[model samples]
Target: MNTSSEPGDSLEKQAGISLREARQTQLLKVFLVMSVIYTLYLAKTLFIPLVFSAFVALLLSPLVALGRKIYIPRTISAFVLIGLLIAPFSFLGVELVKPAERWMETLPKISAQITEQINEISEKFEQEQNQAEIQAEAERKQKEAEEASFFDNWFKDDEPEAKVEEVKEVKENVVTGQIKQGSIEIFLSLLASAPFLIAQMFGSVILILFLLIFGPVLFKIFIQDFPVVVDKERTVQLVGQIQKRLSNYIITISMINGLLGIATATAFYFLGVEDAILWGALVGMLNFVPYLGGLISCTILLMVGVVQYGLVSAAFLPPAVFLGINILESQFITPAVLGQSFRLNPLIIILWLAVMGWLWGVIGVLLAVPILVCIKIILEHLDVLPHWVKLLESEG
Candidate 1:
C-alpha cells in the first residue's frame, strides 16, 4: 500500500510541474509578442518606407525581369518604370491644383450657404413650438442679451467711438499675432521634417531599385542555405507562391482602382459636378481602406453635392451613384478577379486594419491586406497553424 501510494504521488507531482511549465512558456510568448509590437510602433519611420519598397518591388519585379530578357539593364528599367508609375499621379496632382484652389476660395460661400439653410430649417421648426415656449425662449435670449449689455456698459469708456476703435485695434493685433505665430510654428515644423521626408523618399526609391536588381539572385542565395533537399524545395515553392500572389493582387487592385477613378471622373463630369477629377482621384485613393474608405468617399461626395448643388434632389444623386458603383465593384468585380486565394475573413481584416492603422496611419491601412495575404500564404504552405489559418480564412 505504501509503495503504490508513493508511485501515484510522484506521477501527480510530475504532471503538475509539466502544466506549470507550459503556462510559463505561454506567458513568455505573450510577453515577447507584446515587446515586438512595441518595437514596431517605435521604429515605424524606418520600417514604413522599407515595407513600401518591398511591396513596390514585388509589384514591379516582373517588368524588370522581362526587361532583363530583352538585355535591358535593371537600373535603367527600374528608373523608367518608376518614372512611368509617377507620371500619371504627377499629372493628376497638376490637374487638381486649380480645382483645389477654387474650392478653397469658395469654402466661405459654402459655409454661408450651409448656415443659411440651417437657419431656415430652424425658423420653420421654431414656428411649430407653442407660443408659451417661444415666449420663454425669447425671454431667455433677452435676459442673456441684457446681461451682456450690462457687462459692456460697465466696461464702457466715456468716448464710445474712440473706445470702439481702440477695442478693434486691440482685437486685430491679437488676431494678427496668433496668425503669425501659427504660421511660423507650422513652417518650422515642416522645415524640421523636410530632411527626414526627403531621405525616406530617396531611400524607398533606392531600396526598390536594389530589390529589383538583386531579387532573383537573393532568392537563389536564400534557398541555397537550407540543409535538407525537402526544406530547400519547400522554401523555393513558398517564396514563389507568396511573390506570385502578392504581385498579382497589387497589380490587379491597381488596375481596378484606376478604372474606378476614370469611371468616377466621367460620371461626375456628365453630372455637371465641378472638380470632378479631384473627387475622382480622392475616391480612388481612399477606396484602398476597404469598408471605411467607401463610407468616407460617400460622405465627402455628399458634402460636395450639398455645397455645389444645394439641398435638392440633385444633391443626393452623386453619392447614390457613387455608392452603387462601389457596391458593384466590391461585390462583383473584385470577387471575380481576385477569387478565393486572397480572400481573408472580414473580421480578421478589420481587426488587422485597426491595429495597423493605429501603428502606421494611412500607409499601414493601405499595406494591411497585402501583409495579411503574405501571412496567409506562408501559414498555408508551412501547415503549422491550421487553426490560425482557419481564423484568417473567410470559410465558416
Candidate 2:
C-alpha cells in the first residue's frame, strides 16, 4: 500500500539501504586489511623468509623457464642458478673481512683525529669569544667616560681592574674495566647467536631453491583454485606479466648497480682510498635501497676520506664523487631504463621503506622496493583498487 501511495519514499529507502551496505562493506575491508598488516608484523620472523623466497623465485623464474626449454631438470637448474648467484657474494664477503678488520683496528686512531679537530675548533671559538668580550668591555668603558661630565668624572670612584679567570680543564678517569666487560659481553652474545643465524640463512636458501623449482606449478594450482568470479585467462596473463616485469626490473637494476659499483671502486682506487672494492660492493648493494642508500654511501665514503686524507678539502672528494655518480644514476639512468611504467612516487617508496625497515630491519629495507613493486603490479591488475594503484605511481 505504501509503495503504491508514494514512489519517492520507496526510492529514498532503497538508496539509504544501498548506501549503508556500501559503507559497511568498505569498513569491513578496512578492518580486514589492518588485521592482515598486524598479523604480518607479528609473524615477520616466519613470513620474511617466505616473502624473500617468493621474490627470489620470481627473479629466477625466467632463467628456470629457459632451462626447461633446453630440457634441463628444474632441480638442476635451480641449484646451478642459486650457486651462480651466491658464489660471487660469498667470495666478496671473504675478501672484505680482512679490510673490514683493518678498518676496525684503525677506528681508535680515527676517533683521536676527530677529537683533535673538535678541540681545535673549540679553541678557535673560545679565542673569538674572548676577543669579542674584550672589545665589548672597552666600548662600555668608553661609553661611561664619554657620558660623564668634567665634575662628574672627578667625583666618580676609581674603577677596579677587571680580572680574567683562567679556564680550568676537568679530567675524569673512565673505568676501563666496565667498558671492557661490556664489549666482551656483546661479543659473547653475538657468538652465541651465530649458529641460529646461520641456520636461518640455510633455511632461507633451501626455501628459495624449492620455490624456484616449483613456483610455476604452485602458480598454476593457485590459478585453478582462484575464485570463479575472476576470469582464469586474465589471471594467467596478469601473473605472467608480473613475473616478466619484476624479473626484468631486477635484472636491469642489478646491471646498472654493478656498473656504478665498478666505476666507484675504480675511482676510489685511483684516489688511494683503502678497501675500495669493499666500499664499492657495499655501495652497489645499498643502492637497492632508494634515497637512504645514496646517503649511506656518501657517509661511508666521507668517513674513509677523512680518515685517509685528514680532514682537508680533498677529504670531501670521495663523497662528492659518490653523490655525483648517484645523482646521475638515480635521476637519469634509472628512470630511463625503468621507464614511466616502473616509476614510483618517492614519498610512497620512502614510507614503504620506513614501515618495512621498522618491521624487519636492514633486510626489510633491502626487500622494500621489490615488495612494493610486486604489490603495485597486483593492484594495477585488480580492477577493484585503481585509485590505490594510481597513488603508487609517479605523478608525472
The TM-scores of all predictions, comma-separated, are: 0.80, 0.80
State the displacement of the C-alpha of residue 298, model 2, in Å, after optimal TM-score superposition.
1.0
Q: Which stretch of 10 consecutive residues in model 1 shows the poorest summed lDDT?
A: 156-165
Which lDDT tens digits does candidate 2 get at residues 84-181? 98898899889998997676555555655665665567767866777787778777766888997877767765432233323312211133334445
Which clashing pairs does model 1 show? none
Local distance difference test values of all predictions, in order: 0.82, 0.82
What lDDT tens digits, residue by residue, belong to model 1 across residues 107-134?
5556556656655666566445534465
